[model samples]
Target: MSHQRRRGQAAIVYPTKVYTDSRGSRVETADMDNPIPVTAVFVPQRSSRAEVAGQQDIDVTRMIVSADVQGIDSWSRVFWNGSMWDVVVPPAYHHGTRHTRHYTMDIRRRPS
Candidate 1:
C-alpha cells in the first residue's frame, strides 16, 4: 500500500436469492445498490496466473482503504475503473494494529 491517496469506489453486493435453474442446477442472485465513494490505494500482489483445472485465471489485487469502510467481505463486489472484482479475502487489519491506518482486502478478477 502506498501513502499517496487514490480515489475509488466500492459496492456492497448482497445475495438476494437462491434457486434452481432449468437444468436443476443451483443459482445465486445478487443485488448491488448505489456505489459508495471511497479513497484508497490499489496494490497488485504476485503476478496474475491461470489455473488449468478451474480454467479461471486468479488475479489477486489488494485494496487498501481506511478503517472506516464497512460491510465489505468475501460476498461483496467492488467496482473500479470500469471493472468489477470479487472479494476473495475479507477486509482485515494487517499487523494487528486494529486498522489504525488502513484495512486491506484480497480481490480476484475472473475471466469474462
Candidate 2:
C-alpha cells in the first residue's frame, strides 16, 4: 500500500486546554502528544484551482496520503517542513478497503 511507502511524518495538533491566566486573560493551546506518520506528497496548487479559489493573498499546497488516518478535521493543523499548514477544508477520504483508506488534504500555508 502507498501508506507503507510514506516517508514523512506529520504532527497532528488538537486543542487540549483553555485557561485563564493570573492577570485575568484567557489562553488557548494545542496538544501535540503524538504524530501521525504517513507518506505525503506536497504540490503547488494549479492555476485553475487557484483561480477558482479566488483568493490572491494566500497560497495553497495540496497534500496527498493513502491511509486511514484518524483524528483530523478542519480544526486540526499539520506540521511539515518547519511550517504549519492549516487544514483549508475537511479532509477528503476515498478508496476504502479492508486495510487502507486514501486521504487528500488541501492546506493553506500559515504566515510565519
Most TM-score-accurate candidate: 1
Q: For candidate 2, lDDT tens digit of each residue in 75-98?
A: 667787778777777778877664
Model 1: per-residue Cα lDDT over 1-112, one tens digit each: 3445444444333323456989999865434753566776778885546657665566788878777666666666776756777878868875535434677888777467
Positional deviation of 84 in candidate 2, in angstroms?
1.0
* Clash counts for the predictions, in order: 0, 1
lDDT score, candidate 2, position 68 = 59
lDDT value, residue 12 of candidate 1: 36
Estimate TM-scores for all models: 0.62, 0.60
* Model 2 clash number: 1
In model 1, pairs of residues that clash are: none
Q: Can you give the lDDT of residue 44 in candidate 2?
A: 73
Report the alpha-carbon TM-score of model 1 versus the true structure. 0.62
The C-alpha lDDT values of all candidates are 0.65, 0.64
